[model samples]
Target: MREEKLSVDIENIVKKWEGKKGSLIMILHDIQNLYGYVPRATSLQLSNYLEVPLARIYEVITFYHFFKLEPPGKHLIQVCMGTACYLKGASDLLHELRDILGVREGTTTKDGLFRLEVVRCLGCCGLAPVVKVDSKVYSKVTKDRVADILSEYEQEAAVK
Candidate 1:
């Protein structure tokens, strides 16, 4: 329902993928990479640019677990829940994060500082119970270390 003009970057994205097989997903991935999510305004432009139905655009976005509809927080926190991580107390780390952030998994905090998510695996089973913030991986995490991990981001935000 919003009127939007495509950004130069997105225009190029559409032009690059137009009429190509499997273009929709590729276009969507680029959009997500650009904005951290598949935004409504951008979707409108993409729909018009590709002569693709808005519903079809939404179907692909909603079907992919990786696609996000809203803006993500400044920081992304992922707790690994692979079999090894789970066995090594990944649940504890997740619960601690949820308590400290005051938001459940898959939701952003009110301040927009952090977005917490439970992931199936990080593939470092040898380093089970891992927590990743942004790109830094904290291996062998415990419930007690959650605050210190969060504090690093909070402090970084304060400095900037």
Candidate 2:
């Protein structure tokens, strides 16, 4: 029953792009946008519906950094690794986060509350060693503040 709904949803998405040039990427983008990440099942349905091979779907998904194969955590921790940030000890920040959260980059925590990731820049060099939790940016972050920052989120989660 659920599979049928997914098939219809994917079909509607594909119908909008059918017979169009350069539609695969656009279609994948829409799928990712809808699902937060592209489920393997939906990708297979897309392959059959579009007459495109499964390998081709994966090729594009893997090629694009924006596309995610897994659902993101409730709080996405993006640590800036730009030149200024790195020089300001972003690597140490990253390490501390991994140690504290018990999760590496591109992975969510066991509780699904946090996901760690590294980005080249957040465009806030003056605020080097920055970390962004969802839409909120924490600037000039240090290892000492890691626990406090995490605790704030934990508190919020507890309240919710």
Candidate 3:
């Protein structure tokens, strides 16, 4: 909910790459890991500090899906739509989530607590229907379990 709070410590992020241009990508990777997304302000600051061109910074950030330009929701829900997952009722699960959250895929709720997305695969073929909430993975997902999963998020939001 606090977009301003989601920022990378510019000094620290750049200091890690001292003396090496090759460390650029690795440094940005760490920055993304810390901020969830790369804010333009942070990118500009990085460019100024690292002596790297702003265009190059923007290029790398845009090329990587992990480096979002905007701050993400408090919780990111990724539903697997891989062949195995789809055949195992992943679409149905997606619908249930949309209905429950009152939002379509690739959107965040008004409260910013949840964001929904359909991914190609989560590399969990064995767990055909897989859903990942933030960093946690839920396997063997079913319609009946959707409410339980969402309720858990609701509770977490309420607590926050």
lDDT of each: 0.88, 0.89, 0.83
RMSD (Å) of each candidate, 1 decimal: 2.6, 2.8, 5.3
Instruction: Give me the runs in candidate 2 sitting further than 4 Å from their true place.
Output: 1-6
Kindly provide the TM-score of model 3 when superposed on the true structure, using C-alpha atoms: 0.73
Candidate 3 lowest-lDDT run of ten: 1-10
Worst 10 residues of 1 by lDDT: 1-10
User: Over the stretch 1-160, how does candidate 2's per-residue lDDT look in tens digits?
Assistant: 1233446778788889888988999999899888888989888877776778899999999998999988888899999999999999999999999999999999889898999999999998998889999999999998999999999999999999
Against the hidden true structure, what lDDT does model 2 obtain?
0.89
lDDT of 3 by residue, 1-160 (tens): 1123323466676666788858877888877788777777777767776667889988887787767665678899999999999999999999999999999986778887888989999998999899999899999999999999988989977887
Question: In angstroms, how far off is 2's CA in candidate 3?
Answer: 28
Once superposed on the true structure, which residue ranges of model 3 sit more than 4 Å away at CA? 1-8, 99-107, 123-127, 135-140, 143-145
Model 1 local distance difference test score? 0.88
Candidate 2 TM-score over all chains jointly: 0.89
- How many residue pairs clash in each candidate at the backbone level? 0, 0, 0
Residue 45 accuracy (lDDT) in model 3: 67
Which lDDT tens digits does candidate 1 get at residues 1-160? 2246678989888878776887899999988998898889888887876777899999999988999987899999999999999999999888888888899988889898999998888989998889999899999988898999899999999999
Task: Estimate the lDDT of model 3.
Answer: 0.83
TM-score of each: 0.86, 0.89, 0.73
